[model samples]
Target chain A: MLELIVISTLNGVLFGMLLFLLSSGLTVIFSMMGVLNFAHASFYMLGAFFGFQLTKWIGFWPALVLAPLLVGAIGMAVERYGLRNTHKHGHVAELLLTFGLAFAIEEIVSMIWGKSPLDYRVPALLDFPAFTIFSTNYPAYKIFMLAISVVIFVALLLVLKRTRVGLIVQAALTHPHMVGHLGHNVGRVFMVVFGVGSALAGLAGVIAGPALVTQSDMAASLGPILFVVIVFGGLGSLPGAFIASLVIGLVQTFAVALDGSLASAFGPLDPSTGPSVLTDIWNVTIAQVAPIVPYMLLVLILIVRPMGLMGTRES
Target chain B: MRKLTLAIAVIAPMLGHAASAEDTIKIGYIDPLSGGGASVGEGGLKTFQYLADELNAKGGILGHKIEIVPLDNKTNPQESLVQAQKAIDAGVHYITQGNGSSVGAALSDFVTKNNTRNPGKEVLYFNYAAVDPSLTNEKCSYWHFRWDASSDIKMEALTNYMKDTASIKKVYLINQDYSFGQSVRTDARKMLGAKRPDIQIVGDELHPLLKVTDFSPYIAKIKASGADSVVTGNWGQDFALLLKAAADAGLKVNWYTYYAGGAGGPTAIKQTGLDQQVFQITEGFANSGNKAAMDYEKAFRAKVNLSLWYPRAVNEMRMFKAAAEKANSIDPVKVAAALEDLKFEVLDGGTGIMRKDDHQFLQPIYISSFGKLTESEPFDEESTGWGWHLVSRIDTPQAMVSTTCKMTRP
Candidate 1:
C-alpha cells in the first residue's frame, strides 16, 4: 500500500511538472495579451517535430535547444504579423485567429510528418532506470524531465522577479499605456513575452516528444488539459496555473492508481438483476473515470467559483 | 459539424460521374485523409490505387477501367456517412472504407439504408481493416462485405496460441474504451477462460479511446500487477504511447495486439527494443515468403514511399475483381452476390474465403513478432531495421469462428 502511494505520488509529480511546462506559457500569454492563444499547444507540437527532425541530424542535446528557438521565432512572427493585425478587431477576433492558426498548423504538421507518431527515442544516456522501488524501475528519462522542468520553472521565476526585462514585462502587463508614456517599446515587450511563452511551450514539447507519443494530434490531445489547468488554477495567474497543473496531474494520476471501485464502496450489487444507470456506475472502477475528473472539475469550478481558485478576473 | 461540411465539400468534385465512350468502374475510397488517422488512410489509399493499376494492367475488369475515387472522411463517422452519400450520388457502384470501426459501422448502416431506399442505386461496401466483430455479426448488412478478419476470430487465434505457449501465465488486458475495445476485452476473457483455465488475468484497464497522451500511470499499474503478457486492441497513438511507456519503464512483457502492425506501430516496437517480445495477429506481414507479393510490395513501396501495411487491401481488390468477373457485370447487386462465399488466393501466399452468412473474410491469420531482419525476411515497416517474423500461422479452418449474422437479402 505504501509503495503504491509512493510510486503514484512520484508519477503524479512528474506528470504535474509536464502540465506546468505546457500551461505556464498559456497562462502568461493570456495574462499579458488578454487573449487566449489557442495555438499555444500547436507551438509545442512544432517544437516536438522540429526536435525529432533535428535530433536525426544533430543529436538530442542540440535539438533540445534549437527546436524551441525555431518554434519561438515562429510564435513571434505569428504574434507580430498575425495577432497584431487582428488586434484592432478586438479580443474575439484575436481568439478566432489563433484558433484558426491552430488548425492550420496541425494540417501543415500532418502534411510534413504524415500524421503518425514519430520515432523520438530517449537518448541512450538517459534510457536506464533512475531508481528501483518495490521491483519497479523508475526511468531516468522521467527524472531528467522532472529536473529540466524544475530548472525552467526556477529560471522563469528568477527572470521575472529579479531582472530588468522581467520588470519591463511586468509593467507592460498591467500598464501598457503608462509604460509607453515612459518611452518604452511596449509593443516590443508584448512580442518578446509572446515569444518567450511560445519558447517555453516549445521546450516542453521538445522534452515531451520522447516522453509521450509525438504525433500530429499531440497538440490537440494536450491543449484542452492545459486550458483546464489555467482555468482551474485561475486564468492569468502564473502561480495559480502552476498549482492547478500539479493538482490536476496528481488528481488524474492518483485516480488511475487507486483501485477503488464503486462496488467496493457500495457493496453487493448484482448487475444481472436488470439494466440501470446505478448498475452501470457500480461496475465502473475509479480508474475508468479518471480522465473525466478534469472536465468535471472544470464544470464545477465554472458553477461554484467562476474566477477559479487564484484568479483575479471574473472570467 | 464543420468537419462534416468540409468532407462533403471535398467529396463534391468526385460526385460528378460523366459517362464516356470507355466505361470506367468507380470505387470511392473513404477514410481519414487529414487527421490523426491520415497515415493509415494514406497507406490504404495508395494500396487501393496500386491495386487498381495492377488490375488495369491485366486488362480492366469486364473491359471497364477501374478508377478509385479518393475521398477524405477525417476519421469521423458523420463525415464518413456524408462521404458515402456523395460517393453514391456520384454513381460509384463500389465504395471501400477501413480505419475506424465507428466509421465502418456508420457506413455499413448508411449503405444498407441507401440500398433499401433505392435498390437500383445500390453500392457495395468493402471493409478492408475495421475488425469490430459486430460489423460482421449483430450489425452485419448485405450491402457491406468485410475483407478483413473480425476481432473475435483474431482473438480466438491469439488465445489458442496462448493456451499452447507454456511461457504465458499471468495476463493483463488493456484497451481503448469503445465498442471495438469492449468487444476485444470480452472476447479475450471468454476465449482465454475456455482455452487456458490455468492462465490468470491479472489486470484489465481501459482508457478513453484516442485520448490518452501519457500512459505512464497505466504502465505503472501493469507493472504492479506483475503480468507476464498483455492483450490489447489499441491502435494509433494509444498503441504507440502504451508501448512507449512500457519501454521507458523497462517493463518486459509480451504484447499481443490486433493493430500493432498499424501506422506508428513499427516505430514504437523499435523504440521499445523489444526485439521479438511484441506480438501481432494479422492476415499477413510484409516479410512472409511470397515472391509475387514481395515484388508487388517493392514496386508499390518504391512508388508511394510507404510500407505495405495492409495486405488485406490487396486481397479486397483481387476478390472484388474476381467477383466482378464472376458476375460478368458492373452492377453492385451482382458483384455482392458473387462476393458471397468467394474464395481467392491472398497476396502473401494464403487462401481466403468470404463467409456467405456474415460477408466476413476468413483468412489465414498469422501471429508474428518484431525482430531483426533475417535472410528470409526482405521488408520492414517505416524502414525500421526490425521486421515481423512469423511466429505461428493459424490456417483458415482453425482461425474461422462461427458468426451470428442474419443477413437480409436485397
Candidate 2:
C-alpha cells in the first residue's frame, strides 16, 4: 500500500510539473491579456514539429532553443496581425478569433506535416531510467521535465518581482488605466508578455513532444485537459494553476494506483441481500475512478472556493 | 513573337495527340486530407499515388493514361458530399474511398445518388479503409465496393481466438464513444456470447472522443473487476495513450485491440517501451511474402520518409487496376462487372477475388504478440536490432455475402 502511494505520488508530481509548464504560460497570458489564446496549444504543437525538424538536422539541444524562438516569433506575428486587430472587438471576440486561429493553425500543420505523428526520438543522453520506486523504473526524461518546470517557475517569479519590464507588465495587468496614464507602452508590454507566455508553451512542447508523441492532432487532444487545469485552478492565478494541475494529476495517478472494489470494501456482501442497482455497481475499480477526479475537483472548488486558492475576485 | 509562335508550334502536336484520345479515364481518390483522420488519409493518398505511378509506368490502364484526381474530405460528412459532387462534376468514373467510416457512409450515399442522377457515367466506389459493418450490411450501396473487413467480421476472428483461451475468463470492454466504437462493442458482445458463453463480462466503459487523456481510471476498473482480458477498438492517439496508461497503472490483464496496427506499430512499441505488453492485428498485407509489397514499402518509405503499417489503400488500388484491365475499358459499370467476376491473387498471397454475393474480397488477418527483440528477421527494417514477431496468422475469409443486399446481382 505504501509503495503504491509513494510511486503514485512521484508519478503524479512528475506529470503535474509537466502540466504546470503548460498551464503557467496560459495563466500568465490570461491574467495580462485577458484573452485566452485558444491557439496556445497549437503553437505548442508547432514547436514540437519544428523541434523534430531541427533535431533531424542539428540535434535535440539546438532544437530546444531554436524551436521556442521560432514559435515565439510566430506568436508575435499572430498577436500583431490576428489578435491585435481582433482585440478592439472585446474579449469574447478575441477569444473567438483565437479559437478560429487554432483551427486554421491545425489545418496548416496538417498541410506542412502531412497529418501524421512525427517519429520524434528522445535525446539519447536522457534515455535512461532516473531511479526505481517499488521496482518500477521511472525514466530520466520525466525528472528532467520536472526540473525544467521548477526552474522556469522560479525564473518567472524572479522576473515578475525584480525586473523593470516585469514591473511595467505587472502594473498593466493590475492597473491598466494607471499604466496607460503614466505614458508607458502598455501595448508593447502586452505583446512581450504574450510572446514570453507563448515561448514558455513552446518550450514545454519541445520538451514534452517525444514523451507525449508528436502528432498533428496532439493540440486537439491536449487542449481541453489544459483548459480544465486552467479553469480548475481559478482562471488567472499561476499558483492556483500550479496547485490545480498537481492536484488533478495526483488524483488521476492515485486513482490508478489504488485497488479495491466497492464489493470488497463491503466485505463481499451477497448480491441477493442488496438492491439490484447497488449490486450492479459493486465491482468498481480505482482506475475507473481516476478520470472523474479532475471534474470532481472542479465542482468542489467552484462550490467552496470560487475565487480559487490564490486568486482575488475581479470586483 | 517568333519565340511565342515557336513554343505554341512545339506544344500543338502533343496537345492534339492527347485530345484525340477516345475518352479520358477519370479516377477519383477521396480521403480525409485534413482534421483528425488526415494521418490515415495522407498514407492512403501516398499508396494510391504509388499505384497510379505504377500503372502509368506500365503504359497506362487499357492503353490510355490514368488521370488521378485526389480530393480532400477534411473528415467532415457534409464536406465529403460536396467533394463527391465536385468529383462527379470533374467526370470521374471510379472513386477510391479513404479512411474513416463516417466519411465512407456519407460518400456511399453520395455515390448512390450520383448513379441515379447520371445513368450513363456510373461512379464505382472502392472503399479502402472505412471498416464499419453498416457500409456492407445495413447501408450497403450498389455502387460501393468495400476492400476492408467490417467490424463484425474482424471482431468475429478476435472473439474466436479469445474464446479458446481459458485464461481469459472475465472480460472488460472499452471503446471510443462513437458509431465505429459502438458497432465494434456490439459485435464483440454478440460474438462473445455466441462463442464463449462461459466468459463473464465484468465492465464496459465508453470514453468521449479525444477526451480520454488519462486512462488510469478505466485501467483500475478493469483490474478491480478481476477481468483476465480487456478488449478495445480504439485507434490512433487514444490507443497509444490507453496502452501506456494501462502499463503505467500496472494493470495485469491481457489487452486485445484491433486498431494497434497504426499507432502501436513496431516503431511505436520501441519508442514507448511497451513493446512487450501490446498485441496487434495487421491486415493480410503484413504477411505477404510477395516481393512487390516489400518493394512498395521500401519505395514508399524512401519517398515519404515515414513508416505506415496499413497498406489497404495500395492493395485496393492494385485491385482497381486489375479490374479495369480485365474489363479493358474505363466504364464504371463494366469495371464493376469485371471486378465482381475477377479472381486474382493480391501481392500479399491472399486471394483478391471479390465474392459475387457481396462484392467483398477474401483477405487474411495477422495476430501478433509484443515481446522482447528477437534476432529473427521478419521483414526488412531501415535499421536492425528491433522489430515485432508474428505470433499467429489467422486466415479468416471475410465473406460479405452474409450482409449483402438482395437487390445487387451476384
Per TM-score, the best of the predicted structures is 1
Clashes of 1: 0
Full-model lDDT for every candidate: 0.87, 0.74
What does candidate 2's lDDT look like per residue over B152-198, in tens digits?
A: 77787777677777887898888887788888788888889988999
Query: Model 1 - which docking category?
Result: medium
DockQ of 1: 0.61
Model 2 residue runs over 4 Å out of place are: A1-17, A50-113, A122-167, A174-188, A246-315, B1-22, B160-172, B192-203, B220-230, B246-255, B275-277, B299-311, B325-328, B369-385, B396-401, B408-410
Clashing pairs in 2: A287-B217, A287-B218, A287-B220, A288-B217
Error of 2 at B117 (Å): 4.3
Worst 10 residues of 1 chain B by lDDT: B13-22
* Worst window of 10 by summed lDDT in candidate 2 chain B: B376-385
Model 2, clash count? 4
What is the per-residue lDDT of model 1 for residues B332-385, given as tens digits with 9 covering 90 to 100? Answer: 899989998898998887788998999999888889999898988888887788
* lDDT score of residue B102 within candidate 1: 93
CAPRI grade, predicted model 2 = incorrect
Q: Of the candidates shown, which would achieve the greatest DockQ relative to the real structure? A: 1
Residue A66 displacement in candidate 2 (angstroms): 5.8
lDDT of 1 at B15: 68
